[model samples]
Target chain A: MAVDGRDEMRPEDARIAALYRHATGEMPPERLDSAIRKHARAPKDAVKPQKHTLWRPAWRLPFVAAALAVVCASVVTLLVERDGGRLTVPPETPPPDGGETPPFSVQREPPPFSQSMTDRATVEPRSGRAEDAPTLTRKRAEPPREAEVRKSIPESKARIGERSAAPPDGRVLGAEPSHSSDAPASRGNKTSGGNAPLAYSQPPAPATSTSPDRVTAPPAPRAEDDSLSKALPAPSAEASPAAKPAPAANPRPAPQPESAPAPEAKPAPEAKALARKRLESTPSEPRVPARVSALIAELENEPPARWVERMLALRREDRRQDAEALLAEFKRRFPGERLPASLQQNDE
Target chain B: MLAYGEGDVAAFDELYRRHKGPLYRFLLRQCRDGAIAEELFQDIWTNVIRARRNYAVAARFTTYLYHLAHNRLIDHYRRRAPAALVSYDDEEASTSIEEIAGSAHERPEAAYEARQKAARLLELLQALPTAQREAFVLQHEAGMSIEDIAVVTGVTRETAKSRLRYAMAKLREGMQGWL
Candidate 1:
């Protein structure tokens, strides 16, 4: 071979070249070639390409691990969402087209209290209508301005004056006279005579009338009057022979018109008192004991349904004496009526 | 080469026949032992066969082959005890020029002189340092250019050329009368 001119060959290069030209290393024995050829042909003799791959065994572990990790992550995400009470629907998407709102949406405002009362009136017409008519009358009577004006008045002083002044009008005697006007003439004198003393002896009428005005002024007293009017018919219907007594009692009518003016003059105290009296008198029972009357007066602001619940709560808090007294008064006021299950359970 | 990689046994056989003699001689001269040379030769070709499916023709096949051989030799040297690599310069010089020259007879004398010269040349080649010997062998035996030798041996062209020069100088000094 010719040497590159760039490589300046010493004389030794030419001599070494000449020596190397005549001599090369000995060839490997033929057996080595035979052995190597046999090795190279070994796969061919089997007639199959190698099933093994650099990727196969190595890839399996990583792929399996990745798949398992994906599954585990999915499971954990679902569990966490379920435990947290999160809705499955994505936040960005609108909920499925059911008429109802999605669980995550803000809860709808509760139906109005008046709307619920009207609904109850429709559901149970007998007692509910009677109860609802007075409430509706009360709602209609008190203008919003008058209620706001009443809120500024000292409620306790107003209630005390109404209670103290009520007996002199002889309104308690008039309730009996009104009963006589509705009752039969023969029974009217007898019923009227019996009621006049009872009315005079227990000046509960003034107390009851004063409570309504104290608790709820202009509107509620109007409701109490409507309720009392409604209540008068019930007893007359139960004892029509006593109806003649109502007309005889009606002839001496000092208290009849006074009832309406009493509510307008002291709306809060009279409304509260009237509500308590209406509630007690609506049933066949004629009178509520003084203790029960006081208890009912104390709870004048609370809905009637909650009275039992309050008594039971008092008992549960270990106020045993107060609970027992309240329960006994409730039983006396509502004789022959089934007590609420919660109150009964607590009593046992 | 691509066909050989595709499992064409005949193709591989042709490739083997073309390169085997030079490659075997290359390893044999480097190791200066028959068993080790055969072992290295088999190992290199086995690697070639195994690497076939992934083989891309990036450079000349010979350059690629010698590159693998170069790396294998380095690994072999590392594995051996240091004492095994004591210099063979004195041993090579002990063989006299007259012994290498022999007589001036026609056929037998010529044959005797040829064998003696071959033995002496091998001794000189073995006495050279590993890098220089590799450069000389790749140049003369494999017929690789300086550039190819540099590529195969992982060095600059100038380094490969210098190694070849040093190796040639050493051989010439050892066999001056024969030249």
Candidate 2:
């Protein structure tokens, strides 16, 4: 017969039979019972993670903190760099003193001579005769008072000079030679009671040589007259015919002999030496020979004052010729080296 | 005493007292080696202790206990060396008491035959394919229904029923004349 009957028997029949037989039988060997006990005891010392809690992965907390830190740092750095770039734009509106635009307005004006001639013409229409001029006539009549006034002028004039130097229009005061017209009135006032004629006269010589003749000559003549009023009358027996104009007013000229000597004691001599030193210490362009550099270095410490005076004299005679001579001398010394782009051109 | 959910040693000992023998016999029948059965028995009880926090009172205690035992036996089969599966050939010559029934009542002959039959039954058990045997033991010997067998084997009731039916048919056919 087919075994369907056995197959269809209840699921528990086999287990119940096995259990009944097992219950009635002798107990299993003691060794078997003890083995089960030993198995349970073995795992007591094992240190597994607690069953309900997930294992604490050792690297996880530090890893998360480090990742967050890196991301935050990157974001902060990006924001700072971005803000810096936007903040760096050149200021659109200039400061209170203004900027570079005013100088171009200056360069567009008429020639320097024309500007000085205009200033002199404006002041001259109000001027009295040469002998009756307010500053000069008063100085000739009252010498001691003139000297006191002249001394006081420097302090007040220094303040005015500072203001003129900082023009409201933002144009630099000395940008053009035409402004030299403004200097004569101030210098003439200084020379009116002049104890040191050379100090007052030396400035005019440089001014005359540097500025255009039309702009500087008229102002210089005024300064010379101011210097004459300080002279004492000399005794007639010893006076030369050449000194007559000054000796008539200066009945004793010996006390003022020091005025003529002041011009000979020049301070620009030191300034020239310092300028040369600056040039020597500033390294020449790389192509110049070492021998030429050493010569230049020596020249820097002790500039030849005679050469600068000769050069200025030559410039008065002919500016282009003086400039050519200086360039030729420089070329002869360093024929293979090119001049710096700035130095190749004159300061003018 | 610590509660059942606390994983306390005492709670676990009580759990062991309630189910250890049945689970041990179940593994012995499933593995057929005293050593392997003993090893599997300990492993099953250890898994019970380990999973103590996960246990609840929703089902019979035996169902939960035998489910753990069945799972461990399946795991042992998977872990066994390839040569161990092949060693079933050595067990082919052994047979069950159900195999020699006519003279089984003859005193010493019956005693000897009974012992041989028990040995043969174990061999037949080992000879069955792992899935069929697992289904058969969990259902018939563990006293689990098809649904309980499915839960233990992680299979559907249909699959457990099919496996049990096949196991029973094979055993019935093989022991036809002897039984």
Candidate 3:
């Protein structure tokens, strides 16, 4: 018969155990024990790892220093790879030169979205952020509206704090920062310079950034033309393209007339003198494009991709503190957006 | 075991001296064949020696030793094919278990009874199914608690307890008139 297997302690368990032990008092013979003991005693059979002096206190400092050096070098290499080498980096511009560029600007050029957006959307201008995030919304609503663009012109110019300060190098106001003929920057600039690059060919033209031709830096009187003409730099005729067809350096001639009278006439003397001094200070450079104020507005409007590029530039320079701060701001401004491929891996 | 893992031969000798008898008797009762028991006994010790360097103090050394014994026994049963050892979850494994016979199984019951009381007990032990006999031997011989028995045998604690309860009940009933 099969027993019902109930799992409970039995009162007779102790008795059964005692009786079983008494009945079966069997043990392994001495021979088996001797054999096992002999096996255990086999020479060098055990696996013991040998201790090394690397962990000693004396070697600690050198080890730590080497580790730090490796880490720093890796970080530098990663940043360089991310931002690109010397050719891609924009010139170092002071905060005033930043001209309301976003809180972070590894770039000196106006980003694609336009300096209008970059200038108006200042990171430090907390008052403007609520307004700035919605600019894209506003642009989306009335992207090509002349009336809308005109309406935004005054407000944008008003927010432009350092639009007057320009890159110290005589590079054209809106031209590439490192535009040496041999460098890749020159090649990129030639292709990417757009309609404005020809206008900015001579850095001397922006020297007249003193004018309303400076592209609405002074809050121009002609609202309609200045609205659309704001995208053009007033004095960028390196090809003398402005002299013949440009009707004198400023491409959009009508707005320039009013801007020239109202804004340029006022600072024309002081600015020209300052532009001349800067021009003399840096001979080999593009020449004082101090009037890059228009370009300043342009640079401020750069895209997230541009900002990331700049952050990489900062990192390549081993400027980690600045890079970290810029990256943090970039993340804050563009939350939930997937970073570019270069930054995405590092982001994760 | 830890000392032996650190290359102390004497520690291994001490462990062998302390555990050999209980382990040997366990195999002897489970197989009920001296030669096979001796073979398994030596193999288990050889395994212990080979594994000494990798041994960790994760559980009682005795439990580790017994776990090795249980696995060896399972392997032995597997080698002697056609006598498939079903899981303890299946209670009706007696038919196949009878095929796991030792030379002792052929001995006459009359001869067993006529001998000493020890022989009578051994005879009753051999009469039970393989798993039941194993449960009884592990409990009474190694003095393992139900929990240790479950871990060593790779079964649940409740199943180990039930096997012990059922084995003891059956053993007691077998010796009812004689004891």
- What is candidate 2's lDDT per residue for A39-107, written digit by digit as tens? 544453355555323455455778889999999999987875443332222222221122211110011
Among these predictions, the greatest DockQ belongs to: 1
CAPRI band of model 2?
A: incorrect
Q: Per-residue error at A289 for model 1, in Å?
A: 81
Of 1 and 2, the candidate ahead on DockQ is 1
Ranking by DockQ: 1, 3, 2
Q: Which ten residues in a row have the lowest lDDT in candidate 3 chain A?
A: A103-112
Best by lDDT: 1
Rank the candidate models, highest lDDT first.
1, 3, 2
Candidate 3 Cα misplacement greater than 4 A, ranges:
A1-12, A45-348, B83-90, B93-115
Off by over 4 Å in 1: A1-3, A8-15, A42-348, B85-111
Per-residue accuracy of model 1 over B1-179 as CA lDDT, tens digit each: 78977778888889888888788878987887889888898889888887877899989999999998988887787778997753323233333434433421122435677666666677777767778878888988788998999999988888887777767666666666655
Alpha carbon lDDT of residue A1, candidate 2?
Answer: 18
What are the candidates' individual DockQ scores? 0.33, 0.07, 0.28
